[model samples]
Target: MSALHIALYVTGGIAAYKAAPLVRAFIKAGHSVRVVMTAHATEFITPLTMATLSQQPVALDNFAPPRPSEVSHIALADWTDVAIAYPATANFIAKIANGLADDMASTTWLATTAPRIVFPAMNGHMLHQAATERNLNQLGTDGVVVAPTGTGFLAEGYTGEGRLLEPAAAQDFVTYVMSRRQGRLQDVHVVITAGGTQEPIDPVRRLTNRSSGKMGYALAAAALQAGANVTLISTTGRQPPFGITYVPVTDVRQMQQALTARFAASDIVIMAAAVADWRPARVAQEKIKKQPGQETWQLDLVRNPDIIAGLGAQKTHQFLVGFAAETQDLIANAEKKLAAKHVDMLVANDVGKPGIGFGAEDNAVVLLQSGTAPQYLPKAPKTTIAAQVISAIAAARTPD
Candidate 1:
């Protein structure tokens, strides 16, 4: 995400103390912030601290314009790319809901044309009050995005849902909201499979690959940022991003079932999972015991279903993409698979190298497609690579 100019409005609330760290979070993420605090809010968090953290003067009064020419509130409003109401109090929420502009913060909110977000922080009882609910609904109707509050201990010495969200979660929420506003894949449904499928050999043993699912998770996040409704069918148990459908599976059959259920409705499908090619012909219900005199053992194996190929054969309107993790003859093998699987695109990478692919933080891949020259993306962070792959898919999905 690009650096954004954020106009953060702080209102009077006990959660106002968190505004400093919130500003630091935005700055740490490479964004610029300008703070506007209510007089009551200043009692909780000093404007000087906000000014120091934001590296810009805090806007406290409607009449305290530094310039004699331009109105300060209007200038701040015009400069904003996104506006957020941090620790939005009941009174402040009502004022904004009713278009009441008594303070510099409210006036700037009224004047700004940027996308607006609000994070409510108040007593649980007050938050659940009919008046507060009505005000929040009104804010939503006015095109303000109301971020969900964290449920935890409140200032009243009781646990409730009115607590301010932690800094990391709050930043993630903002990122999601902004991504939705600027995304090109709005309303698109993307189904992605990730991680290495495990084939159980016995009660205590299993067969799997080196995949850690980092690339797949990165793809999911990138797809979400592009405004797609994403469904991630993963073998890993890691927590997914805030706005995606997460389906966990252990073997290729389970992954195939999950993908088949969502395939018809999906606009795009990415086969990023390192599915095992074979499974034991017979799995032992109990642990296989090693005979005292035996030096070696033999186990029969059966070929597993080719999950992505099945999807490719059945796909009608879906833009299917597959991954090829090769050790040798990367392009040759990937090109053959591209035709054999009938996928729209193939991402081929050499996993034989050390510290690059398969559980590595970075990756390099060559994009293969029919009737097009091979496009190589140099090694970079998985997140950057995922973004590039998503962009490539988006471009390919569009016709000339």
Candidate 2:
């Protein structure tokens, strides 16, 4: 991930103290932190304290203190990668939801195109109020991330669900959101398939491949960071990450069904899963126990659905990206599949190559599109490759 610059909004709440530690944590993790505290928030934590911790001037004024040419609110909002509202009170949440810019923080939020995250901390009753609930819902509907609150002792000497997450956990939450964020993909629905599908034979035996899902997962993460809503159909053994939809499948049929269900709503569909070419013709009712002296055992194989070709046959408005992992005739075979499957673009690689493809953390690929020359990306981190793919897709997309 690139180095991040954060605009941390501190609102009026006892949890404002937690924001102080969070600033240091952000700095320690090599991210830039700029604090923008509400006038009321100064009562709970001093602006001097926050500034000292963040090592930057606190933004407290609506306009520049010395140079009004620089609108403090808008400048800070535009400068940051993403903004976090720690100890976001119901009043402040309402202000943000309804577009009220009475204070510098609200005004900054209104002006920012970057992602906005709110960490609500208030009295339990205030948090539970219908207005607060409504504002929170509105924020989510508007694509803002609402961090979860914890139940703990409030400054009021009572335990409730409105307490802010601790500094450490809050830091992690910020990292998670930032890691998955990409402004280009914002609000765009994307679906991706990853890992090699498993075709079970008996209860204990199955056929699979070397696909680690790294490339596809990288694509999913990259699309997510680009601000696209993502759903991952994974055959990899790993669990899915938070914030995106995940559908686990073990066979090609399951993957096909999942893709069919999701493809209609997707703006882009990436077929990255390494589906099995064949499966057992008959699955034994129980494990096929080996005979003590069995010398000959035959297993029949059957062809699986050509998922990409099927989707391509009924092409729609969605941009389709297909991957070709070949051991021979790399470009020729890939182009054949691309044209045959009606793929909009093809990412082809030699899985047999050392240090690239399959389970490797890096990749080298040739990108082929309908009307463009082949674009070659040399070996690089999967995340970097993913960014390149998403950037290319964004460039190719028709602007709204």
- Candidate that would win on TM-score: 1
User: What TM value does model 1 have?
Assistant: 0.93
Q: Summarize candidate 2's per-residue lDDT along 110-221 as a digit string, tens digits.
A: 9988888999999889999999999999999999999999999988998888989888878757766875653776788899999999998988899899999998888887
lDDT score, candidate 1: 0.92
CA deviation > 4 Å runs, candidate 2: 1-5, 10-31, 36-82, 89-116, 122-126, 129-188, 237-243, 295-297
| lDDT, candidate 1, 1-400, per-residue tens | 5689999999999999888999999998889999999999999989999999999999998878469778898999999999999989999999999999998999999999999999999988889999999999999998999999889987888788899887777887888888887776888999999999999989889999999999999999999888888899999998787777899999988998898899999999999999999999999999999999999999899999998889899999999999999999999999999999999999999999877779999999999999999999999999999999999999999854
lDDT of each: 0.92, 0.87
Query: Against the hidden reference, what TM-scores do the models get?
Result: 0.93, 0.72
lDDT value for candidate 2? Answer: 0.87
